[model samples]
Target: MELSLSQCSKLTWTLNVHFIVLDCPGTASEQAGKSESCQGCPNQQLCASGATKAPDPAIAEIGAKLSSVKHKILVLSGKGGVGKSTFSAHLAHALASDNTKEVALLDVDICGPSIPRIMGLEGEQVRHAQKRSKPFYVDDNLAVMSIGFLLSSPDDAVIWRGPKKNGMIKQFLRDVDWGELDYLIMDTPPGTSDEHLSVVQYLSSTHVDGAVIITTPQEVSLQDVRKEIRFCQKVKLPIIGVVENMSGFVCPKCKNTSQIFPPTSGGAEKMCADLGLPLLGRVPLDPRIARSCDEGRSFLCEVPDSPAAKAYQTIVQSIQDYCSNRATEVQRAT
Candidate 1:
């Protein structure tokens, strides 16, 4: 909850049962008794009632560091094994393909950092800086950062609690040397939990471009994807669009497409219409796409003419258009 305070005074708030006192810009005595400074404060009741507290201090640093980037897009899936990470890797590669633009792919899935292996940077290590850490360079236009890089071995497991995971996420946002970039595509773990809340809170100051949700054509996946959509709505994050992956299977030799996971009653297109969201595109499943991923090669780059690759390009174009339109609106508002 947000309350606009018109006056400056000492405010006492509790966080996790611990009391924290903050000195506002006005008189100190206003916190105790009625004063001129507290007359028009919108948050007077909140402060007096001690209902809410200030956000974490690291948020400011996160915002400051992320301000250099033009856009931040989160790639998330409600259910696991939905090809979310693969989509993020391809999206980043496609965006960075333009030599004029810079892009950073941040793998925020602490427990499962698949981006490094998917992007073909498995054994890379993170370089340290005085105040931040350097991202591993993929090329002149592309860079990547992930906890997988910090591990001594690929088989090492990340055993952490909610607070520990949150702290690491804060560190990633506040201390990463992203430099100036056109986009930062974050691949989040499946589900809305501590990591998602932490990332959203840290980036509150930065205007996050939006989120791209991924789902398959099955009802089971769509059910979870529905919850993911509601999570975005509850958090007020704009849904740029949705992509239906593995919607169908394409034959390599026959050049024919078949619905492997055909919708029983409805699919992404119908669901999007019901939710008032745009169905970005449908990506048919192809064996070459999986083969490319396993080989740590971008299917989009390796087989640009494939049906799945073409679908990805179409979705990327839609996202670019959305961002361009949002930028124009911001310029007009300013």
Candidate 2:
């Protein structure tokens, strides 16, 4: 029996275990509507509510595509305005600044694509080659991509639903031509949304090296960060560690550091201790860091001797150590 997409509704198994192919929701969903098998799924609520879906990611395709990339790191924050994106940009910049390693920065923050602006590639567009889009090269060692590059203007808004967002992220992972790279740093939007879930699903085969969570010193921010940590735990994503951004304000004239947010008594340090996670480093609140970001300049280059720059270097070193150790472990297993 032949059926069109309109005619096919439920996904069922016939006698003798014959598979009945129906028009899927285009994603792996366990909703108890068209598919009879879905009715018996334990995670029906998770699928039906559209909170998260277990999509059948193209593992082989993604793995082949990202085979050359040595490491894939995701920068995330449960709360907004924790400087996740800024940290991502600088981290990539710092890595690429090494001159020996190749780095790629991918901005998956669909609604608010700021990497193009932050990286000073606002007007740059993604070029195509053999059907695969090429990432914008910031330098010989650095490349970047963002939905901002696809937009007509930086001010243009991306009003998309969850499925659309997921599709775009999938395209980024599958279609973008990111040759060999030392690191592919993804700057995700605030909170665990469709983008975060999609990235994890698609790259499950390619392997996400780990996640670096960013947070401020205030209790309001730390409280939300706790949720971010839990999200990683639930998803089984190994967290590299926590970074305490804006930990203190460095005085420009006197070369002094002050506790601006006042660490909420225990703050990030104590929180990390309680969670048994490493505190990578503390990034001080510096006006120059903001100025460098706004001007599309590399903060490390502008203020190599600054305390914040030194902190970033320390954090980057810790990340390198983590990646190197993981690589060694994989080799031993093989």
Candidate 3:
């Protein structure tokens, strides 16, 4: 059983080729071929040649395209059905309410883009011009873009792989004419997937204000949120704060409050405390909120006096403060 080092290496590679392929250092990675896992991979030689290491010129192009955008914010969630898109829509609406600020909302959830429906632009299509494609404008100041608009029908499925999804996101950033936005809010899909990676990479040269993570009160949502937080940290993206959605439900008849999704393990507040993160105000579960979204209307305008609306106003104020403070610091540094 005493084998030479070369024999041992060959045996290891042979035994782990499948696993190594699954987790290969990408061809663009500097460690692509040098890593031990690349011993028997098919792309080893090509990767080792350093051909794929060339930087994509699109990153710079996207940065320049979005230079007119002042604050870029990504709204993310750990899991689906957590109202990530709803928050994104409302955030854009609230920001544009001032009429002085121009806001753009870009939905990069390629697989299940709900922004079009939620934003009342369901059947809208992107208009191509001489150079840049124009996004559908919700109003004079608010513009919206989503893969939903490209689909012939809302029911059509986008069964694209990672590469295609990444390409679409790149086009959204580089091709769309956002045109001097005060804020560009990207409504990202759940989890740290290809879409998330593409947006972060494409905006690397740009100054991203931060991300607003949305979560429910239950422990299940909190668990996934921890992973999201780690992803943001690894990517060096700033965390503006965490918003606890559906924290509780209030009775319209009696004005009593009840925990709809009970925070079994102390919810986002406890989680934020443990992680030293800011706990953005919690939004109560309001049936009217769902109705407004279904009807493609703004809940803030519909129920401005409701507790949920008030909570949103507070959270949005916090975000505005954060962005203003960040801009001040950047100015000082410059």
Residues 1-334 of candidate 1 have per-residue lDDT tens digits of: 5444423233322221122122332222236223333444555565555333455678888888888999899997798888899999999999989899999999899999998888888887654444238888878999888899888788899999887998889888888888998999999999988888788888988999999999998898899999989889877999999999998886767978788888764888988999999999998888887888777789998989877899999999999999889989988999
State how far residue 219 of model 3 sits from its true place (Å): 0.8
> What lDDT score goes with residue 73 in model 3?
96
For residues 219-295, what per-residue lDDT tens digits would candidate 3 score against the true structure?
A: 98999989889889978999999999998998989989999899999999999999999998899999999999988
TM-scores of all predicted structures: 0.83, 0.83, 0.90
Using TM-score as the measure, name the better of candidate 1 and candidate 3.
3
Per model, how many backbone clashes are there? Answer: 1, 0, 0
Candidate whose lDDT is highest? 3
How would you encode candidate 2's per-residue C-alpha lDDT over 1-334 as one tens digit per residue? Answer: 9876445665333321231223224235444333544444444455576555544546568888999999999999998888988999999998898899999999999998878877988687754434347888889999998888888776788999988998888888888899999999999998876888888888887877999999999998998899889879877999999999998886878978788888875888999999999999999999998888888888999989988899999999999999999999999999
Q: lDDT-based ranking, best first?
A: 3, 2, 1
Quantify all predictions' global Cα lDDT against the true fold: 0.83, 0.84, 0.90
Record all residue pairs in model 3 with backbone atoms less than 3 Å apart, i.e. clashing.
none
TM-score, structure 1 vs. true: 0.83
The CA lDDT at 290 in model 2 is 86
